[model samples]
Target chain A: MDYGTTPLHGLPSRVTICEVGPRDGLQNEQAVLPVEVKAEFVARLVDAGHTLIETTSFVPAKWIPQLADAEELLDAITLAPGVRYPVLVPNERGLERALAAGVRDIAVFGSVTETFARRNLNRTVDESLAMFTPVVARAREAGLGVRGYLSMCFGDPWEGEVPVERVVEVATRMMALGCTQLSLGDTIGVATPGRVVAVLDALAAAGIPVDAIAVHFHDTYGQALANTFTALGHGVTTIDASAGGLGGCPYAGSATGNLATEDLLWHLHGLGIETGIDLQKMVDTSIWLAAKLGRPSPSRAVTALGDPLPR
Target chain B: MDYGTTPLHGLPSRVTICEVGPRDGLQNEQAVLPVEVKAEFVARLVDAGHTLIETTSFVPAKWIPQLADAEELLDAITLAPGVRYPVLVPNERGLERALAAGVRDIAVFGSVTETFARRNLNRTVDESLAMFTPVVARAREAGLGVRGYLSMCFGDPWEGEVPVERVVEVATRMMALGCTQLSLGDTIGVATPGRVVAVLDALAAAGIPVDAIAVHFHDTYGQALANTFTALGHGVTTIDASAGGLGGCPYAGSATGNLATEDLLWHLHGLGIETGIDLQKMVDTSIWLAAKLGRPSPSRAVTALGDPLPR
Candidate 1:
């Protein structure tokens, strides 16, 4: 078998990875990384073969001070030609900043649960969607690719359990609006395999193509990988993962961030799944970031594979 | 709905927890946990509602230096009435020591993979089983309950994949030898949901009672909980988990330990399964143990809970 970028099956010769470390990851860290370090980290990720890199979120500085350098970071970082770096844009203003910073791809997010929408983004579910409509329209007119995030699609902290129909309705609206792909976010990380199956079942029954669906899960409760397997078993391929489990939800107190890329890739490779990302490189990057943050990694794979500390 | 210890589906209103931190947990840690700390830790676990605990192994001290104080720890720890403390016995000699220590239960382990068995215990698969036959017979005659472990039942380090038939054969032989329950170990943590389903199906087809089976999984590749879900869906009730995701095979270089008890309980509770362990208490104990080890807890759930660090 070829060591680098080998095909899993005859179906495809490669896998596309959407690295969310710079955006989802850095935003969740308690220690705000310096702009130079953030630029270096993003450059390292690009060097490590991450194609679809989520650069930064264009949220207000007061909302998430960690990524307040979104504009500067995007401008300072060296961009490679084939790499597609997408920034999170909440409104036309955020989109304008991203476009000004030379961003060719932008992502807009809304919530499925009204309670979470109000608490997280300070808007109602409908209001959140409406806020993104103009952003999506303006981005599409600028020849930019648009991706919509449906937060708390599986469950919400305040609402406990979300109805599948509500998630589907929001997802359908996003897809119908100029968004090319819909990523379902299990924001609070309370999902199980059965619940994942239930959500996918409802969505498929609603005449949604599995190809348009991407699953995002946090490893807060360690169900991310299982849920990912369930999603993959449903033939929904796209997955969003942080490089080192670097992100955590501030609202969902004590919630870990997105699934670790190293851990997720380890399982994918073991199961003969073709994910183009390198596992060892991802582990090394996690080690570096964990040291920078003065902590052990949130990723189990990185801990297990990295060098053992002297007793 | 009550969150307290109430009966679910009329199956025992309470659960019997067996903490493997002493034998299964500490043996896999790089640094040796002091005998006093180990004893105190076991005492704390017992105080926190664990009635049955696997205290330590009877293996030679030279083999695993980290657990060299097994006898001392077992001797110094206070045992509660009706609390069954079991120790692993590799052979007749190991059994003699455990029996002398007043242990009421003895566990004998055999691996499904010949390669893992040889690398792990310095004996081939058949040789190891042959070595355990007399130990099991002796434990039975000595009026001690016997539990058998089939390691690498899911996957192995040297051998990439293990067949279900191989696991069934080992399980059947162990059952015929008077082992009360067979704990299938996912040694390298490569078992996925589909593979777990297939293994359970094969075991059932061979007439193995689901109730008599316990699943032990490592989160090496993040599939332990997923595998546990598959086992539970098939009616297997008993689960084996470590306190803080401690322990890994000495043979498998970077394999993670068993799934964290807190994470497993969270999923089981979400599924409405009756595993009478308190989630909060488990998290507290894990944090306490991590403090003793002077490192972050391997469990994401423990860290995510964001409880104050143990003094």
Candidate 2:
């Protein structure tokens, strides 16, 4: 509806939204959909103009039953031209599965703090990075782009406020593992804008160009969009968002969903930045998925723009 | 819980949050609480360390039956020392009512667009301003502080994209009537960070000091916090918020609640900015109010921190 535009300096004219709804989002959701539905979800995101979609995770089904049909879902969906579907591969086994499935882009998740590393990865920070090394190395050898996810960059529920220097050190180590992009995760959604800027500044000082960094924020504290805005001001062009704000942190029970793609698009577009996303189409997709899950979408944009659901 | 703090440059170390829950928030709610409950709400807000609270509106009960007990509610609440209770006064008669009730601070509501002025104030923009002129004048004459509220400063449902210059002109005129503070309201909640910057810049160019301005944003499109952050960066220290995200625009059907005070506190305190309000106390008050209203608070911070209610 032409929500007015006023351009800000120092912001990129265009941004790439990394759609994580299919993989990260579904992995955390309780309702397990059919493989066909998962495939359709990926297709709808592609239709909504998402070029980079995390299609699914190859983690063991025992750990995440919601994405148990990763291979079947990947096979069921038609691969669109010029779109990149990145799958999460935890270790060597998941990498082999992704390789067999013809995945071209893959992501390996790590943690910045020892507590989260032990809790989420069943290892210390060093052990998790050691685990990701082989997966990232083998994927890079296969000519596949690797994205490193460094979680708990802001605040860890168990560890409290994470040190900025520690984040920079871990982020550097992860980026050195043949990763093309590093997405800093606010796993607990506890980051404010200044902390976001501090982390980005530290990364830049460590020689990590803004172009190679992406921000992944959770809206648990309603600071995701503002954090994303701060990241954009620092010249980070890629944002990791779940369509419909689908994912909640499994490790931190209080964490809400990722920054909603619809909400992010509203801000990006309203600032005269190009996202190439159809906001209405994305909102409609969230509504459609919400119905499938028998729940309303957590996205504020979806709630404000979509029709009222029947009681 | 200490959310990590990293101070940003050029932001005020402390900000004044104007609590608008009792007046703006409750006026939009469907359930009409008794005058005693309304009084308790104000008392709770003062206890949570809000120095400026909009206690009630002296508008006719026929217009807003939800706030029919404005005088009684004010009478029931004990005013805390060093706290300011500002009541909304529409015109001469409303000012008389507020004065009779011993109100030391009064606010006059105006519009930045013609349609909203006609629809909400039942007059044109000029007519509305003319009506507020006498009210603001009398309030100032009586040695009471006068606040001017300019709504639809960002966008309007009927008249889309209100011009920046128009907002500046109306705001200048409103402030000229001896308003100690002028609040820019994004009533429809369509503002983004850039638009916020644009309006604030225009106002500054027109000789309006940042200290004399406040921002009132709605979370309808999930832009309020981001917009608020942008406003803070522009040196705005006064933020208008409703506890528990309580208000929705009566004129804009799809509009969501105001920026929740708890959510705003999370961002402000996380940035190392002080608000003097206890976060836990505010969340508790919102939880208590939500229970009385038979609904959960829309605040993300409250939802994340407060225990989940049984379905």
Candidate 3:
């Protein structure tokens, strides 16, 4: 419990964790919980001091049955005053659905690799960008903050290692769509620290400030926290994580879940960086949600500190 | 897998991994594997390009029945040239047994906290040091390499938080006792990157060179890999790991296993740090060992890539 507070140089004094358990996490789950449960999940996260939570996606019910009750979930939960609930909006139709739900922040998910763009978004790279362009434009016009998610920025299943230049190009295009923040994702979770530095340096070289970038990593090879450490050293302040390491890549068959929020907080809070989230509360939330999901949480922090709350 | 080799500025280009699955890992398991299986495990690790391995301990059979066949195991396996197999020796008796078994490298385990020293070594901190003094002296006089393991270097359950000065003091004593190398252990896995940096910096300030220090971390809170990354940044080239994340702290009820060698290799190899071990071979070894132990591996790399061996 006593994490000796020692701050490192060149790292952010505070970090913003964007909880994606309700959306990115549940979307890949086989068990579809009721809308009320999803609502409670978001509420528990907010109670744990998460200010930014990705509520759900507005995709069609037939596509992702797990998150089909997005509208009902939004209606079921109370919106905290300062909390920002961002929903993933794939295209113009999804954006319309989000707007109707009184969403203030929306995110557009794009793919860095051509193969993933076609497979995941059902469009080529440029076509997917074209689809998101109007969605972002409309969201921006509606005074909704737009967050751009660039998936497969590190690697792609069909197309091996993604080029940094290609990621930079797609990232700039996504940012040009009026997105306030861009979450660079290692979709298949094959990124190491060096590759992380390379991509971030390339983005900086392309005139993209570190403040505008958020890192979303997976623990597929147990490199998530280490890679996150590298990103923090590069001055990245925003991170996307799931409560219990909830979601695996639906595309990459061997991919693991997103970096667990508990694990990330353990690293952040130990470094004397203020995140404003209660570690114990978040661990309890993850444990409670894991029971609802009929499985144990994959987060190491949850596994180690979950059973009896570890003093 | 095209890890995009980009070396960090301050990290070591090559790292030496000391595989402890046979000794440190198996010691905590309820199932005591046959000596033949243990020999094969060591063989497989050597085949996977591990240059250094902790073969077994010289403790009495009553203390650790799991490694009771230490002499038999040393005789059963073929010791490859250039590979160093270190055996744990508790005192002069254990050292005599290790020397009788023809062990060229022996390690003495000490504690940074007094409570753990009394609980684990059955002696107070200074008393334990006094006990190890003669063993280290005799080992060095016998032309054998000596490694000193300082456990609970970051936090202690009974003591709460361990001071940095205490760690440096014990580390210097261990080194002064003629230990060729000293491994700083985060026994309960409660360490973070900043604390790791702080400890290493304090040790460096106390005239303990980085090259003489190795890091042994547990993944109790999922901070092992992140903490290892911090150690590498501090120019510590040697790392202690277990195949398949084999061992858990018997003292800490909620503690998980040691840092998985497969997971560690995934990070090190991905960073373009030359640790000669083959990742696939190590994963296969963990999978095979997990099967023999009748349990799935705790390593994320094994879980993510072990299903069918991703292309």
Q: Estimate each model's TM-score.
A: 0.84, 0.98, 0.99
Note the residue pairs that clash in candidate 3.
none
lDDT: the better of candidates 2 and 3: 2
The local lDDT score (0 to 100) that residue B230 gets in candidate 1 is 60
Candidate 2 TM-score over all chains jointly: 0.98
> Which 10 consecutive positions of candidate 3 chain A have the poorest summed lDDT?
A302-311
* Among all candidates shown, the one with the greatest DockQ: 3
Name the candidate that leads on lDDT. Answer: 2
lDDT of 3 by residue, B38-133 (tens): 999999999999999999999899999999999999999898999999999999999999988888999999999999998898899999999999
User: Candidate 2 chain B: worst 10 consecutive residues by lDDT?
Assistant: B302-311
**lDDT for each residue of candidate 2 in A235-290, tens digit (9 for 90 to 100):** 99999999999998787878889999999999999999998889989999999999
Q: Ranking by TM-score, best first? A: 3, 2, 1
Docking class of 2: medium
- Residue by residue across A174-210, what tens digits does model 3's lDDT show? 8888989999999888888988999999999998889
lDDT of each: 0.78, 0.91, 0.91
Q: Kindly give the number of clashing pairs for every candidate.
A: 1, 0, 0
Lowest lDDT sum, 10 consecutive residues, model 3 chain B, at B1-10
CAPRI-style docking class of model 3 based on DockQ: medium
DockQ of 1: 0.28
